[model samples]
Target chain A: MNGDLSALPGIVALTLGVGAVATAAMLAPAVALGFCLARGNFRGKALVQALVAVPMVLPPVAVGFALLILLGRNGPLAFVWSALDIDLVFSWWAAVIAAAVVGFPLLTRACEQAFGEVDVRFEQVARSLGLGPLRSFFAVTLPLARRGVLYGSLLAFTRALGEFGATALVAGIIPGRTETLALGIYSRVQLGDESGALALCAASFAIALIAMLVAEGWLRRSRP
Target chain B: MSQRTSRIRCHIDRPGFSLDVDVGWDERVAVVFGPSGSGKSTLFEIVLGLERCAGAHIRIGGSTFDDEAAGLYLPTECRDLGWVPQSPTLFPHLSVSENLDFGRARAADRDPAARKRAIEVLEIGDLLGRSIDQLSGGEAQRVAIARALASGPSALLLDEPLAALDLPLRARVLPYLMRVRDQLDLPILYITHDPDEAQLIGDIIVVLDAGRIVASGAPRDVLWSRAVLPLSEALGLENVFEGGIRREHGSPTFVSNAGLQLVLPVSLDGDTRVRIGLRAEDVVLAADRPGKISARNVLESRVIACDDRDGDVYVSLDAGEKLVAKVTAAAAAQLALAPGSTVYAIVKAQALRRLG
Candidate 1:
């Protein structure tokens, strides 16, 4: 027990930043995929849905290993990374990639459920009012499904903040860099810093609580 | 009138149902009248280009929306026709004004003027600030109509706009629809199962049954035509008489716009102008004027046509206004009824129901 607590702020900031970045990065794709799943009727739809849920159901470590193989040297697309002169392993971006992969299923599932709850008639009415397909979705369908999407985003953000196995595998727990709250807690407990681990736990709990409270307030306020 | 024409020739095949209709009319207001499963809404969907039917030809107000032969099909948004679907589909997330603006924003021309006219004609001005859920059934329908009209469409397509409302609410909303019909010069394609609504709102009634156009012509003539008697009788075809009430000899006398007078069973307190409904079955036909009959009203009417089908005879008559009487085939034969036969239409005052 060194009784040193100076690394707390850096770890908290890195954790929050990683969660925010990863959630932001996945927002558009998740919404698009979710809407497609909710409304589309096509061949191979079941296979697509199953593939989307694979990340959520599979072990996070396995996902990290797969991502590691894809982004690591001596793997496919290795020349692209080498050409770009970028090393992705054990970096902040690697942690974001890991968090995004793990949190994607939660966000997408939420979006699909939310969009499914919206009546297609609203979109049809919007289209009949001279709005194109894209405009109708934004003006009618998306707003109607906002609560579910927002709630799903908060779920993914919290999941990203707590991402441990995937982040640890792809992005090693480097001090003041790739280390987040969950990784910090694991590393602190392993190093016999019980107080540090407890502090990180409290921070995680506080962040999860505040994010949910804000989302609930927003959802209630915007309820039709 | 510019001799506007609306035409729809489409064949839609669905599981356990098929809609094969070819109907066209020169009237500005063409109504698709039918029973519940008669594909009235489906026909509307085809006209709006919402339902894609290959080789379907839909032309409204001289504008072609779908002509599959020419390989041209305008999407629903590009149809440039105001469509009020069967249900009131006001956007729940928006206020009434926002919903109106949603349509007005995309209007090609007369943006503000169209919006203003829609708001005024539908009488939804006071309801503009309210949310959709806060509105009553009638108010929501009015707002829905206004929203459609605000788009400045070349024509309007209404799918049973008053079907969702109760009787009183329908009455309250129908005048707004009538005002829309009278005030706006746009061609209207209205749909309904109610014969009265068909008679009142539609200049040309296209009777549909089993996903087919049974008859299409002038409202009264087509509705009472031999071709439409079976379907119209099943729909409970009602003679809709529009008139005013005045106290004659201490009793309220109902005088229709067409100069037919009748005694009322119940005296209405207020509102002199009213519409009454008389069912075909409620009208009893007598070969001779009955002396000392308990029935309140008796009028001599010339038979236009007698359709004997399914063990009943439907006598189409001209008793000042067009009226129908359903009598047994035996009674029809006993009276030797046929076209140009002089008969008496005995209508009990109690049989008349105040529609509005």
Candidate 2:
């Protein structure tokens, strides 16, 4: 019990730090995809939408295998990996890439719905007031959709914190290198370490519960 | 150089209908009056550069904003024109002051005097701190207009800005619109379907029907024209006259166009030219000149046309001008009225209402 307690601070820090980086890396692409899905009209739009939805519907293991094929030592980018003299696999960066891939869809769908609900006439009015399109979007549309964006980022962060299957496959369970809270919990359970598993589970539940509460409060405050 | 005139010539082809119009204006308030689906809004959208138009040529203040032949097309932001749509578009996420400042910040001129004048004219100083959702419909509209004005556009386009308000609210907002037109020195293109609104503020009136300009002139001239009489008749204002108030035999009278004089109960104090409207039901028709009638005014007229409407006969008469009289078919048969038949149209002085 004392040993598990001693390891708690390090586990929490690793989970939070990795989750934040994964969410930040996914932010711009998620917002752009959300806006396009909500407002754009183009050929193959349905195909693009279906492609974005794959990560949400597919099993987490399948996503992990796909990433391994792309970033593994003998994978597609072997030459670049050799040139950089650093392997991405079994590293903290591998965990972030895995978490970002898995968490992207939730962020995108939430933001898409938010942007869809905004009236286009408001943007048009802004343009008529001498604002260019991009300026109007930032001035009018983005502020109106801020609540959804925040909610989506929180959801993505939470998803990243609990990421296990993809991170295990790509980043491996190296305790001090890449083992997140979720992976730590799994490794402890597999090794029959009951006390460590329980502690990690309690910590995960606390973080997720706090995230949900904050999200609910944020949505209420920002609703128009 | 002569005072610049705004000219618009455009052709917009839609699925079920197309709009083609050529018009020019230099008036302080140029009103676009039309029925629903008459392409009035489409015309405004084209001028604002929000909707694409083929072969569009728009020039304001001697600068060409859009000319297909000249291959010139400016975007909405570059056109420098303010727009107030029918609904109040105060940004939901902003306070009144912040919304107003949004436009002020983007204005090329950015004159503090103009911003101050707009805020004062709209009377929205007290609402600066209020959120958009807290405002009444009339207050929101005032804010929208003020925001547009703060942009310092050379012209303003108002698309039925008061149509969403109830009657009392519309009345309250109208004075501010008039002030903006009269005091701002900015040309305004006002679109509306309400005849009263068109008559009240229009320096030049353009009537559109079926996506075409039916008539364009001064309000009185267009409203009283033969092309517009049927529209007014359908709107229940059967007798519309523009005339000068005069004193005859120590009594007040109204002398209308075509040299027809009408006895009035009271004289207008200031205005010489007055617009008077009477309902069709108010005019009593007689085949022969009646001897003892309480009605104070009578006109010798010729019956021009008659139509049956819901068991009543709507008789059209030329009493030195066009007039409509609603009488029963039985009464028309008893009087033996027909085309070119001479008749006397009797109306009471109290029945005449000052329309504008």
Candidate 3:
């Protein structure tokens, strides 16, 4: 338990670092996708939307396998990146990218639903009032959809924190580097260090509980 | 060819229908009278630039918003037009004050002074800090109106803004429109199908029917023409007949359209095709024609059709064409007027509307 608990600081950093990256990756695209789905009329939108949701539905390990081939040293991605002299194979940053790929669609889907739920009537009123589309989106649409977007961001963060299979497959479980709480605990369990694994599991439970509480609070606030 | 505010004439072509409307504003409240789906909103949308349709050339205050001949289209945000939709679409996120500011591109001066002036004009100073959800329907509508007027637009287009509200609520907000007319001093294109509203707000009334302009002129003149007379009839206007001028001595009496000659209750001019309306309740039907009756106007006609609506009977009489009259079953039974019965349809002078 002492050794397990000593690893908490590094695990917490890994979780925070990965979560921040995931949120950064998801937020911009989520907003753009939300607006596009809310207002755009185009062919192949359905296909693009299904492709977005696939990462969410696919097993994290399965997504990792696909990414490994695409992003590995001898893979197509690395061949392209070879001229840039950047290594994506076994690094903490690679783990964050892996987490983001798995978590992005959840945030985006929630944002799309939120944006869709806002009545276009408000936008019409703003336009009539001389507020243009850019001003209208910021002044009306964004504020109305805030609660849903906020909750979606929170979910993305929590997902990135709990990510294990994909992160481990893409960015090997290097101690104090790529090892998040989930991956750290898994490594300890494989070594038969039951006490260490138990400590990490308790810490993960506490973080997950806090995340759920925040999400529930936001959900309640979004309603009447 | 002549331009004051510049005559607005545009032809907007959609899939199967086109909105071809021509309006010239000199110094009158022009009413766009039409039913829903008769391209009412589309007309306003083209003006506002929210919709794009070919061959729409719109100019307000000598600024062209759209000119299809020149391949130009201004976006809605830059149209500089005031608009009020049927639904009171107040921004849920903004307070009453912010909503007004969103359209205050007109007063480019001190922002606070502009807002203060808006609050004063709209009389909504107290509602400035209040959120949209807290406002009532009437309050929300007033704010929406206030917000539109704050911009000091070149043109104001109101699309049946009072239609969604109940009768009492509509009555409440009408005075504000009067204030807008007086205070804003902008050319208003008020759209509605309600005749009463048209008569009230319209200086020049344009009647739209089935995607075409059936009639357009001064309010009274349009409503009083033979071409537009049938519309007034359909609106339950009592049929007034020319009852002839002064029975034997000096008095003004008129003949009705159905050739019913009667004495004068009020002063009326020469024998003409004076169309009128009879309220079903106004006409007191009798079994046999009474000669010495106090009522001024009376006509003999046969019943055409009778149907029971609620507790009253809606009886149509074939005078010249179909003249609909309302009567109770008791009145119908007393007269024994069922389809083939010939009876006298008595009308008051006041119920007889003149079509010039």
Candidate 4:
């Protein structure tokens, strides 16, 4: 029973790694989509926004099921995965893909609100100063909107840390492979290891609390 | 036309308002003069290529920025014109020095000499280290202008550069504007609603009213022209005189450069050189000098021209310096006002507003 507790560190590390990798994977796409929603005026924008927000509002298990079918062995993309000789389902990467899908909407929405707060005239002035569109975005718009973007990323990362239903359905409870803190807590309770579940719960709470405190401190220090 | 002349033709149609103007000038400094909502800023935006007008043609300093007929239109960045907007739109995230560097980095060719001159001319060398929010309004405006100049633009587009400042700040910033105009040797398109600023700074003036060109010529003539009298009256056009003050019989008197001595309501102090502004409606025209009148500085003058429009007469007077008087048509008829008619101009001491 004491030896089973040795897997605690591996669970915490895998959880942190999944959250970090998921947040990093979605950062660029989220910023681009957020900027487009904030500034672009075109037809069918509402449809695009609604589609992007589906994973956030839908049931997490349902999203995991959808992803399973899309990347499963018998799925339409099975040949592509087989051609690459990569097993996506029930793997560590499957956990990352699930976490990224759920966190994308949160990060993208935050980015949209952040970019909206920036005045368009600043970009116009930048262009007048001889900066092209991309350069102006980096030099003026992105810097001004960095706070909101960072806060959004923090929200998505924290959300990813606690993701259980999707990760459980897709990655399964394979210790040191795909079992994160959330899945480990659930698996320990099923195994009747009450002390192990409580210990994992405490570790999850500590990491989340520390992450939030550090993010708040960093954000406050950056205020101009 | 000279090789460096600027020409612009724009026609914008909108609901309840339309701006249609076709004007050109050979002078290096052209002032777009008009009241608010008269499309003065719109004209500048068109020149800056911020607003695209179909079939419009713009040529400044022998460069064709936009020509619909030629299928050529340069973007705002490629226009190569320095634009100082109404507000000092300095980047809040950057310090003054960074803002200037941002502009300088994009120049076609790096010219350290021009960048140094812009900083020295605006006297913003001390402000380079400060962030935008730490600076006052006047300091921010100077930094904004310097940032535009640091880009090494081909021409300059200044939209009411002094309008955002208060009277004292305007006075402080005017010299820097003059320095940019005099020292830079660049073609400039300036927008201003103030007649005094127009007269003092512009080599030529374009008067716009209700989105149309009412008159375009020399500043004094364009504002005081017969066609622009009604619009100018709405703008509160004032007759400005530059002179020195002297003590006469325990009261201060203003001796204008053209040699007319007039009593002032305010006491003179510190600097003797002063600029004063009088509204056209403030000057009273009488056939004979009144006796024992409360008004001071009654001077004999001859009418240079008489413009009768919209039930009012705009009488141009040459009383050592140019002055305009506005009176009803009935009053002009009673006084028999006409060109070359000698009249006594009655100016009250309190009517003279001190303008620096």
Candidate 5:
């Protein structure tokens, strides 16, 4: 049992590192898409919205397969893939990419709701005060919607921490290399190592609980 | 100060309603008088470039912000104008001083002296540290006005800034607006549905109804015009008149511009121009002259229009001065009232209220 669980610390570090990186990388695109979905009026808006929600509703394995076909080594991106001469499959970056795709819809939906709650009048007032539209959005709208954005990021972080099917297919559970907590637990359970699987589950619960607590505290502090 | 003019010619189409207006004004304070849903706010939005209306031509101080025929359009940020909506929309995440600084920092021709004067005029010096949520309605409006002034705008547009406050708070904030109009050199466009507010602050008045300008002139002239009288009457400024004060029979009498006279209970020491108001329900119309009456003023009038409300009749009378009398339909029928019929308007001394 001890020998099997020796990789627990490595798994924890990998999960935390990949989760944080994925959350950070997803923030900008999520915010932009959220604002557009909430405030913009243009053609193909519904199509864009549906595309964003695809990963959340579709099977995680299916999402991973779709990503594999697009970014895999001899795929349609073969020119750039050969130019870079780098393997994206079975790498830590693959885990980050899978986690980001799975968590994006949740983050964007939360952020869209948040931006929708902010009154457009505040932005108008900012523009009237001589700030341009983009500046007004950054200065007035974003700060006012800070709590929502923070909560969405935390949700995305938690979701990234538990990503299983996509990470398993894309990164392929290499011990001490790309294995996260979920993949480690799955590997232990498949190998009939009940104690190791239970320990990994406990760690996952703790991380999720901490993320929720921080989100709640942030929401409380931001309440006007 | 050199005279400046604002010219606006716009046509906006909305669902179920459209606004088409062309007007110009050089007054220091121009009041856009209209009822709710009169496209007053839409007019402001078009001028501020918040709403797009094609073929619109807007020029202020010789600068063309929007001339659609020439295909030139300026965004709201590029326009040299400040706006205060009906609600005091202070940024909730900021303090009062930060809100004021927001305007000052972005102004192209930022004026520190003007900002300091605005702070002094609005008397918001002590509220600089308070958060936005801590302010009362009146205080928030004062801060909003001062913040707009800090931007050093060439013109200011206020969309019923006092409409959110109660009567006492509105009264408290109105004087600050008056001070801004009197002290500042910029033109101001104040939109309001209340006729009293229009009369009190308007140097020039433009009356709008159903998205069209029905009348435009001096406050007394436009507000008292036949087209605007019914709208003003609905807003509770019925029987409004501009009159000169005079002493007669040891009492003060008000002689109106239409050559009608009324004995007022209150005394004005010297001869001065004053506005007088009487409630529509307070004026009693009598078909026959009564022998013994305690009412102070009685004038011969002709019934011009009678409109049937729920159970009462709104009788518009021309007593040399326009007066509206709300009486029961039974009484109107009993008196056989119709257009061009003679009647006497009996107003008690206490019913006449002096407005500024």
Candidate 6:
């Protein structure tokens, strides 16, 4: 590796690309789960809530180990990949999955809080306005809670950028490919490259800080 | 005009409360009056289909929204009912124009004329460009109402739509409300706990108490009904007796309901539908009929029930119809009055103020 601007595009792509895909996965699943928890009335709601929060408390390595058993080539779900003729192990996609797993709780928790803070009166008013339940949610509930959704997205993105332990187990830092900024920092430190590790660490922190600031500012600007 | 023959029947069951009622409306405004936590908003929820209920049958203008027995149900979106809530809730992210357009776009009648008509009807054309956040509470409320009205709904359901405003702001919005009521043919279900608001706008009053409709009829009849004697005494309003005045004995005047005579100070005509005010404290009870007392009005009344609330004790008496009087516990003990006890009720004629 040389100190040249030629590799900047790949590095930028890695930074933005990993953040975007992993963040999207985290945001999508967590939001879906959040919506379910927020709106559903069932006997097992408390148990379901406990299940959603389990990933947040578990050790990152344990989470990676569990995923490895379910998703690895020799694991229980190996046939699923074989049937689809796809590769998941030791790939950039695996890194995205690991990052998403690490990031999902942040997104889901934020989304759940956002949805909870919403007043039920809005939905009632919408229904009384002649919109049905489904229409009311789309027309009023979703729009009113948009700020929270955005905040959750930003939180997920930051969490995804910082993922290390789970990605390390699932994807195993591969230079110029599966190597995320967090993984890159770890590798640099392991190889006794102090300057490189510090540089990457500072970059990652700056990215996360900027993301939080933007999200906070946007939410404040859009508050009802 | 079709609304005159139709009334809405709604049944709702919630935690700690349930409401079952069949209500119809004419061209006139029907105000649902009740105390706080009397399931007013919950009733609106069932009617609006925001909250689910079992065996609920609702109809507006003969259009069936829910028929549990028939297994027919129409969702809220198809119901086409406008709603105005107390809070001035407008979509914050959308400009007022977009918010107005949001409802119009979803409405089955999406004509430009309909959209324009809604803005004109609600009188919010000037606030179109402004964002929801920039609006004052009143402006936001107007926009919300306009957006709902844009849908071309069959009727309007208002859930304490003016409660969020202070008295002065409420006065400001009254004209617009009056205009809407006068100009539009739409039937409106106005819910309020305020007696003043009810008296101002209500043609028919449906009084709800503790999840049940206690009384419903013309506002005048319900307000001063002998059936609601207990409620009036509880409210500490001026209570009056309806009867004809009989011959005077000495300085005391007598008014008789049916054949039951009550003494008062005023001497008036013998046969007329007259109302007299007899304050709860002014009414003294005696176990036996009294003579030579300054109290002009006296009656033989049987105690119906007793309710001790706060500092005042309420004794409900049935003097043909019913009468409730608020007395101190000391006064109640002094009279030795309990349920099923017969007593003489005396009201001075001066207390018999005539009502129009």
Instruction: Give the best candidate by TM-score.
Output: 1
Task: Give the Cα-based TM-score of candidate 2 against the true structure.
Answer: 0.82
Query: Model 6: residues >4 Å from true position, as ranges?
Result: A1-12, A132-135, B1-4, B10-15, B24-28, B106-114, B229-356
Model 6, B1-356: lDDT tens digits are: 22444455667666787787766655367888787888887777777776667767677555667778789887767777777766876666678998777666456563345567778877898889998888887777777778877777777777787788775576556556655666777777789875545544566888887778788877545754656545644554555544565455454344445455665544443334444555667777777899798765577899987767655677878776566677888778888778999987776657665431
**Clashes by residue pair, model 2:** none
Q: Which segments of candidate 2 are over 4 A away from where they belong?
A: A1-3, A83-85, B1-4, B61-63, B108-110, B229-356
Give lDDT tens digits, candidate 5, residues B206-270.
Answer: 88999999999898557655677779878766566667888888878988888878888864434
User: Which wins on DockQ, candidate 4 or candidate 6?
Assistant: 4
Which whole-number lDDT from 0 to 100 does residue A143 have in model 4? 91
Chain A (alone) TM-scores for all candidate structures: 0.97, 0.96, 0.92, 0.96, 0.97, 0.92
Best by DockQ: 1
Per-residue C-alpha lDDT of model 4 across residues B234-257, encoded as one tens digit per residue: 676788776788987877899888
Interface RMSD of 6: 2.4
Ranking by TM-score: 1, 4, 5, 2, 3, 6
Candidate 4, residue B29: CA error in Å? Answer: 2.0
The 10-residue segment with the lowest total lDDT in model 3 chain B? B236-245
Cα lDDT of all candidates, in order? 0.87, 0.84, 0.73, 0.87, 0.86, 0.71
TM-score of each: 0.93, 0.82, 0.76, 0.90, 0.84, 0.74
- Fnat across every predicted model, in order: 0.69, 0.83, 0.73, 0.48, 0.71, 0.65
Q: Write the per-residue lDDT of candidate 2 for residues A15-98, one digit (tens) a residue.
A: 999999999999999998999999998999899889998998898888988888788779888888888988888899999999
List the DockQ of the predictions in order.
0.73, 0.64, 0.41, 0.59, 0.52, 0.35
Looking at model 1, the pairs that clash are none
TM-score of 6: 0.74
Query: lDDT tens string, model 1, B24-111?
Result: 7788998889999999888888887677887798899899888777888899988888888878988998999999999776675645
What value does the lDDT take at residue A214 in candidate 6?
98
Output DockQ, candidate 1.
0.73
